[model samples]
Each structure stands twice: as structure tokens, then as C-alpha cells.
Target: MICGVKQPILLVLVHSAPENFEKRKAIRETWGQDQEGVKLLFMLGIANESEVEKTLEEENVQYKDFVQGNFIDTYHNLTYKHVMVLKYAVYHCPEAKFLLKVDDDVFVNMPNLKIFMKLFMAQNSERKKILCSRMCGNPVLREGRWGVEISEYPESMYPNHCSGFAILYPHDTIFALYSEAQKTKYFWIDDVHVSGTLAKKLCVTHIGLEELILSDDEVVEIVDSSFINNTKPFLFGRMNLDVHQIRILWDFVSKYTPKKVILDYLNY
Candidate 1:
């Protein structure tokens, strides 16, 4: 079991590459900081090179929040990474209320996520659901970057699946999905396999599409003061943000002040 947290209400498992040390540091110093009721962990796969492994070891020693799996760290192996997280959660943090799976590049608005969760739970008190932006009607690419073999997936169009960049799962739903994954055929696409195929097989609730707040347009406006005040985003993606961009946006969101604050004080 990965060390450093116990019985947290929310466990954020970030899927990260072995070489993204700066990105990891930015996340840690900003929104990924330790908070009450929340636990943050970075999940990675084994590094191929010795130097990278040494760096990973040092980082793990310092942070004690890195979870490494036995598989190679590659885009196609993301499903393995997801499975490792599920196995770890089931074995170690079965008591956690929710598990949030996000990529290293995504910016999570923890405050907004908390508010969204509270409202979501209040509305659907007894439902176990996975929350993410639903993606459908996408044809399976037969060539280049995201190509898949006919043997891997025979379907021409992908079933409705959450965007793998960020997803929130109820504890029971994760446990059920993980169990189903053990028996199902492996698919290289992590989102479709874990959230779509396995989730469908297990009959878990999936809240998709507009229900999840993942907009690149909104992410572009994250630096706007008014946008920060008016918006409550659960997670932001398609952000190939550098360390500087990460820090800048984090500062804006963390220290935002609504336009009404000054007006209310003046009126008083």
C-alpha cells in the first residue's frame, strides 16, 4: 500500500509520466497540497532508463506519495496504470468516499470540485456514479497517433466514455469496475476500457457530457478575474500548460476576488 494518507474522503490519483518532475512539483506546491479530508498521490509506471529510475526513487523518498506500477510508462499502457490505481485503492483505501482520476497536465479546482461533490451527493444521495465529460460518435482511428487494430476493438464507433483526462468515481463504482476489469479483455485505450466498456459491463452509473465541466474555452479564460469569480469548474483539461502557466493560473484561482467584494465594502 502507498503510504502518507489514511481514510481520506477524497483520493486524487494523478496519472503522471516518470520524467515530469517539474510538472509534479508545480502541482504539489499549488492545488495538490495536502488538505483536510483529501489525499493526493501521483501514479506512475516503471521508468526504462536508470537515471529516470534514480530520480523517481529520490522523489518518492522526499514526497512518499508516488505509486509506481510494474508496467512500462507509455501512452498505450495507460490502461495498466489505471488498473494499478484501482487495485491500490481497493486494497488500501476502501473507506474513501470518492476517487478522482486526473492526468498530470490537468488543473483541478479543488474548491470547486468540493462544492460540486457536495451538491451532487445532496441531489443523488444513494446513487453510485462516475462523473466526467462524455465523448461519443468518434470513429476509431485506423492509422497514426491514436490508431487501434481491428482485433483490439471491432466497433467502428466508440461507446459513450468519459474523457480520460479527468474522471470522478464513487468508491463502490471503482471497486466494481476494478473487479470487472480483472475478467475483461484488455484494451489499450484507458478511458474506453475502464470507464466505458468495464463500466457498462458492471452496470455503474455514468454521468457524462455537459454534466462534467471540462472546457478548453473556459480554461483559456481562467486567468480572467471575472471568470474566476463567476465560474466553478470541477477540472480543466487540454491544458498543455508549462510550469509558469500552472503557477499563474493557480495564483489567479486561489486569490480571486469577486467584483462585488469592493462594492459591498463601499456600501457598508
Candidate 2:
């Protein structure tokens, strides 16, 4: 165990947009009373001062940080937002061990995460320095507004996945990412700009994973046992997971008895 317990510090950064609030609540409800030793930091995204207060009143959840300003527009702007948020965590929330950057619509399988980290820690504590996810090489798309020609990089540069939706970064590495960004202009697309482009420029190595915490539109069924058994646990990214997929994954996990999840934010 890293700190008298096996759980790593968990920070679920959710942009508390209209649709995001209910979605995030559902995710927390999924945890119910099962996740222990996980420190949750709900990140609410707001555009104005009033929205922040309104969010606080409506949700009734204490947030670790309230990120303001609209810095992005297109699909790529997310990268900059993510990088800046991570930077906030690094500079502000130093206690967090592992930072999980996820979208409002996404659902994370926490038990699987715990199991994966357990194995990772068992193998090498140094592994915490690198970002881990199922590596999606930059794709070449010709028909969409978001399509881009994949750039060629040395095998060393293309470590694994480039999907920026859901990624896990250790505390130290996140600091490095923010440091790198300060040296350059903020890019609009946060994934390539912050996670891939900026990180690549800094030479921070990324580890390839098998399962992705972020999903595409496709539906995937993940089992609790299978999740723990996964040799290569990945954070799903890129797919637009519909209701069907969510049900599949949720129902599957429901088969297992949930461990007691507690939230002592005030005491925390």
C-alpha cells in the first residue's frame, strides 16, 4: 500500500455543465458505498461567477476546484483545458497520487482501476511517473471536421495511445506537463496540444495499455473479474458509448458485491 492503504488518491475531474452534473452524479451513485480510500475531487467547469454559485447550490457538492474561462472551441481545445486542469491539480492538490481526467459523460470502473494499480505498484513504483492508457495511435480521418493526417514519429515517440478523452497521470508527471506548457503557447486542442504534442515535446514517456477508460460510440461489456484479470488495463477513449454500452458494463459489474464506498470530504 502506498499510504497505509492500497487505494491511490483518486481525482475525478468533471466539468459541471448542464448534462455533466446528472451524469457525474450517476457515476458517483454507481460507486455507492464501495470505494474506500479514494479521494474524489469534483471539478466543476463554469463560464461566469453566477454559474459557480448556482452550481454549488444545485448540486450540493463541495468541489475541490472551480475552473473558469472558455479557452477552447473545437474538439482539440479540450487538450488545453485538460492540461491546465491537471496543472491546477499539480500545483494546488499535491496530495493526489493518481489523477484521472475523464469527461462528464464517461463512467469509470473504479474497482478495475484499483486492481490495475495494485499490479503496477507491485512491479515498479517508478511506473507512477508515466501516463498510462490504451494507446491509440493518431488516426487518419478524411471525412470529418475533426479528421487529421497522422504525423510520423519515431517508434520511441509513438509509445501507444493518443486518445485524450480519459487518461491517468501521476502527480509528478502532471507537474512536468504544466511546466512544459508554460514554455509554449496554449494550443486549442487539449489532447494533442497538451497530452500528446506538449508531452511529446517534453519527452515524457507514455505507457501503452489494453483497456481504455474512455469509449467510442461502440458498446463494451467489462466484467469485474475480467477487469482485475486484465493484463493490460486501459482507459477507454474515443468511442461515443451509447446507453446500450453503459448498461452492458454497469450490469456486468452489478453481478459482483460492491465494496463499501465512503466520502468524508469535510474530514478529508
Clashes of 2: 29
Each prediction's whole-model lDDT (CA): 0.77, 0.52
Worst 10 residues of 1 by lDDT: 259-268
RMSD of each: 5.8, 8.3
Clash tally, candidates in order: 1, 29
Give per-model TM-scores: 0.88, 0.66
Compose the digit string of candidate 1's lDDT tens values, residues 1-268. Answer: 2334564778889999999999999999988998877888999999989999999999999999898998889989999999888888898778777888988887776766665666666566655678777776778998998999999899899876888888888777878888899999999999999988898777766676252343556656764433654434444534566777677667776776333311111100
lDDT of 2 by residue, 31-120 (tens): 322356565544543433566457655665453334543542234455556765776677656666677776655555566666655555
Best by lDDT: 1
